[model samples]
Target chain A: MSNTPNRNRQLRSKLGRVRGLGSSHEGVHHWWAQRMSAMALLPLSLWFIFSLISLTGSDYVAFQSWVSEFGNSVFLVLFLVSMFHHAQLGLQVVIEDYVHSELWKMGLLLIVKYGSVLFAASGIFAVLKISLAG
Target chain B: MAEDDRPLSPHLQVYRPQITSVLSITHRATGVFLSLAAVMLTYWLASAAYGPDSFARAQAALESWFGRLILFGFTFSLFFHMCNGIRHLGWDLGWGFDLVKLRMTGVLVIISAFGLTVLSWVMAYSHVGKL
Candidate 1:
């Protein structure tokens, strides 16, 4: 058993050897998630901008009616979810890079992670409330 | 701590600002700004859900001069981040790595971001018949 493990380690590439030893064991996941969310946000963000333009000078009722529509509500929720996910991941990288002290880094990371979830939940709830109630 | 004083690889302080480097950092800075902006977005949605009175207050606050200024900044930052993000995606696909192409794309990203921001604001103001 020991020899087999040693053989496997020897066969690993230089980069592979240290793959999961870093803080986040899931390698490339953060990078991949960021890119995927970015792609999703491209169309969703465009939709949001145009929608806001159309809603220009409109009152609360106009905005509410827009959100109450099924497609609009769905897209709004999707936009919020992806936006927060991307924001959290991007902010995590920024924090990790600049915040040298492990304590501060971890503290900010926790705040961002939790704050994103909380904000996302609130946004989604609001959308659902308008869509269903109105 | 003494070991930290040892010479390290070239970092931000050592390099004269170049287009590629400047844009790269700007991408990060805009991204952070947008993250903060998401709070306002949530506030808008939540206020709308709360009630008509709350929504009116929210709209009034956002439509103020200061609010418009912030919104304009948010708009530019968002478009800049989006345009540059596309450039980054292209690089990830192993395209546009040549020095000339890199500079070209960097410039293109800036122009496109500015253009889109201007276009969106124009559409917005035109829609409301006030600019």
Candidate 2:
């Protein structure tokens, strides 16, 4: 009748009478997002590097023109999204690995994940506004 | 052989440190560095979008001595993390697991990271007139 024991019961291993219930749906969601964001980061990262190099000495007008380009803005948006999401995933793992206190770790993870999303969305909107307005 | 049935063998305390260990530690350190760096990326994008004054501030920071040092550290961390991640990807693909190969690859990643970092700085400096 105790929920605590029943919760443990759901996670039993195959060698035991039951396998411990594997990751919940939320766990799978985070894992999938991490992998997918990493995949997105791969090419976006390369593009970002090249873009930085290309824009090295360009003035404000030049940079404005660059961002105003349809393709440039599109890729830049992708890069921004992937960068923040990947950062969230990486930071979550680091926190989980090193943060010994469960409450602190959970709080930090939530702050990091939500903070990253908010920052990424704000950044993306700024970019779209600039690119579209121009 | 039954000992293999145990989940994980020989815990952390049993291991001694070495050059490879140092490099391994740096890989994770740089990873955290780059993760934080990604937040800076958001700032850069936002600043760029905010127009000239904001953008100039971002550029000014990057051009400052302290900023240059941080940028250099970031560049090194980026390359180190990338090389080490590729090594990991190789392992994930079931390649490069032999002892000799592992050591060689570890050294190779460190070397490549340094080489790429220096090369990037050289290119960046060579183009300093543009900034």
Candidate 2 per-residue lDDT, tens place, B1-131, comes to 56325454234456897656767778778978986677777787688788889999998997799988887898888888878877876776799888888899999998999998887777765676632
Model 2 per-residue lDDT tens digits across residues A16-91: 4343234442435566676677667767776776677667778777887888899988998887788787788878
Off by over 4 Å in 1: A1-24, B1-11
TM-score of each: 0.90, 0.80
DockQ-based CAPRI category assigned to the predicted complex of candidate 1: medium
Q: What are the RMSD figures for all models against the true structure?
A: 4.1, 7.1
DockQ, every prediction: 0.69, 0.40
Candidate 1: tens digits of C-alpha lDDT, residues B19-126: 999999999999999997888899999999999999999999999999998888889999999999999999999999999999999999999989989999999999
Q: What TM-score does chain B get in every candidate?
A: 0.90, 0.83
How well docked is model 2, in DockQ terms?
A: 0.40
Best by TM-score: 1
Clashing pairs in 2: A10-A21, A11-A20, A11-A21, A12-A18, A12-A19, A12-A20, A13-A19, A13-A20
Q: lDDT per prediction? A: 0.91, 0.77
Interface RMSD of 2: 2.8
